[model samples]
Target: MSKKALYIRHKAQPGKREEVKRIWEKYARAYIEDADGQIAYVYGFDDTDPDAIVAYQFYDGEAGKEDFVKQPWYPDYERETAALLAGPSEFRTITPQWIKGGAA
Candidate 1:
């Protein structure tokens, strides 16, 4: 089973979605290209609500993730984004223990 960390944001306003997307994009790219042991970082918006932004981050291990978050760029971005964000963003770390048969 692989481990993943999910970050969910239920946007408070429609206008700020673009800015949020840009921020996520920047961070996601950095995670994949610069950070060590990061498998992938993907994000998207809710189809129905549109106000929701979700990020799925796959890591080689938990340690890799811990190091990634502690990087200087990450905290700087977080601080700058605090006010631009609507509310508290929800965070979860998940381990994929099982998979149903399916094709995408």
Candidate 2:
């Protein structure tokens, strides 16, 4: 099966960008690094929007993505992240058609 990818765009509450980042690091960064079937993960700020948080993730397949989100800790992550977000997040699923260097 083809790899599954996700693009997430989030707007943090005013002046909460750093806090959002901190929470992500606490909840997800190391987890993604060691997850089975996860190909890559990227988290960073938008170049044009200081309050925007952007993330890209690549997984071996849809199930890999699902497994990641189905963890027991996911709800805690959701609740915390939601509190710092200004509004709903934007999520997009992608199927890769080309190869590139690994995520940094």
Candidate 3:
């Protein structure tokens, strides 16, 4: 089966860009330490909009993605970051065609 990927775009509330980044950093660390079936996870701010943050998470397969979302930490993450966001996040599910060099 092909890998499953999730793309999330977050617009930070005013003056909350750094806080959002920090929160993501902490979450990523904990996720890496505790979760399984993660192929790759990448996150960064938009070049044109500092307040905009984007994250791409690749999993082993559909089941892997489902397992990740079902983890107990997922809800906690959502709740912790809710107040820092400007609005609802944009999400997309994808199938990776190819990944070239490391993300820049």
**Which candidate ranks first by TM-score, i.e. highest?**
2
Q: How far is candidate 2 from the true structure (C-alpha RMSD, Å)?
A: 2.8
Ranking by TM-score: 2, 3, 1
- Candidate 2 — worst ten consecutive residues by lDDT sum? 95-104
Best by lDDT: 2
- Per-candidate Cα RMSD to the true structure, in Å, reads 3.8, 2.8, 3.6
In angstroms, what RMSD does candidate 1 have relative to the true structure?
3.8
- Candidate 1, poorest ten consecutive residues by summed lDDT: 95-104
Alpha carbon deviation, residue 52, candidate 1 (Å): 1.6
Candidate 3 total steric clashes:
0
Residue-pair clashes per prediction, in order, are 0, 0, 0
Model 2 accuracy (lDDT, Cα): 0.87
Tally clashing residue pairs in candidate 1. Answer: 0
> lDDT of candidate 1?
0.66
